[model samples]
Target: MTTFITNFLEVFYVLIGLIMLFAGIESFRDQENPARIGTGLFWVILAVIFAGAKFLPYLVIGILILILGLLSLFKQIKPGNIKGIDEKVAEKSAQRLGGWIFMPSVVLAILSIVIAQFTPLGGQIGIGISSVVALITAAVMTHANANTTYHDSERMVRSMGTAGILPQLLAMLGAVFTASGVGELTAKAISGVFPVGNHLLGVALYCIAMAVFTMIMGNGFAAFAVITAGIGIPFVVAQGGAPVVVAALGMTSGYCGTLMTPMAANFNSLPVALMEMKDNLGVIKQQAPVATVLLVIQIGLMYVLAF
Candidate 1:
């Protein structure tokens, strides 16, 4: 089962690589884009990395990553001429589908859980399988043909621009931080002035650190290892807090940061581009109040529950 899942994942990644390769080709053909060459090269390089990373040497992968960084740093990655959505067609479809338009999303969530909980495929494989299933379900329900699906997928990827890969990059950054003892440095810095033994203060520090680190890094998962190592275990768990509660609340507290930060481009910026919102920060503005409330609530919850 493990081997099968591994093989399946490899194939799935290859398929994704092919899609990105096609996107690169489309970018090259997009005459309207000023940085078309750079954009095309970006996708093509990403495709090669994705498809061949397992076989490629670490040095090669590192070089490719550096190149990707340089491209993004230079503002070479841009969304080209994405076709605007036809309002009339969209409205007609929405009216026809009504609440059924949401069925695909419903299926995606429920099916993912069902597969993860009941099957030997596990959560990661289940998520991949569920995504493909959800895509097929959406296509069938919408009567979308291959060409339509292909074009829509391409446009969506293009619209996402560089933000599409931010999560992966940030996750990698987190791993690098972890390996380089960033957490230990944080621990040393906080230990000097912060009273670590006080349960409430420790809980607050842990939760706040999670949120702030997540905001800085744009990923809760990335923040989790660092924050938990630096703050959670040393202050909370070692001080008699329940391990499970501290870990769970610590992660969600990070999500509060996710809601408020523009650095979380996948969540904040992608929506603005996709919806063509007039205000770039509209999503973050709407989410700030909720995030603030949630962070406070999480800190309280951690204090109450962890102990």
Candidate 2:
């Protein structure tokens, strides 16, 4: 019975993903409602990728999905024209919703929290209940405003979709890589080159390394996986510095790296694409000075504080 229930839940998850994908695709076709179309496509892509991860290797699929999502976020792509029928329906929907669609999320959140506190099911059950409540609230809100012509919900979904939970997913991936002992091995290799007894210098070097790695990787997250394993948990901890402080400072220093790399596409490429800049490196060029200054400050601060 337990196995059957678990399998059912898994199947349900896949089904939900498929439904989202299909709805998104359908929404994308409404010519008069470009926003809804974009939103629907985004949801569909998300759902398809998530569902695909169940049967396929998650890491490969995840990387592909991430790349595709990021590419979609590039501002250079022109939106397709919306038709009259789609536009009229979307406008009507928006009018009925009064332009404020997020109201239901707030109500659902409150209800979820309330249920979480009083329910006997504890954390997992409470979370599940809360998600259901939130979904229902959104559905009810959408239905109530069904007669309204506003396509704002679809628009909202599109605008939020690219930024949606991507960072969290990346962070989780980095965590998994870090936990595989790659971080420690990398840290040890680097530490071998430095002499012992120079605790402050070592910490400073680690910070600098983190900054450089972050810049090269275009993501502090990826750098964190490597640096934390190589330097943060091992050297910083072994050197009598607080692990929390080192980890925190290390991450801050990584942001300095974000300023210098084109690989930080979200921070650099997205803006450049949006502005239609002639120079692809325009964002990085502008940010370089500020990033350098910040990096120095972070490295110095961490060294002093850690040592």
How does each model score on TM-score? 0.81, 0.53
TM-score of 2: 0.53
* TM-score between candidate 1 and the true structure: 0.81
Worst 10 residues of 2 by lDDT: 75-84
Residue 276 CA displacement from its true place in model 1, Å: 16
**Residue-by-residue lDDT tens digits, candidate 2, 35-56:** 6544555576667765665677
lDDT of each: 0.88, 0.67
Residue 27 in model 2: lDDT: 62
Q: What is every candidate's alpha-carbon RMSD to the true fold?
A: 4.3, 7.6
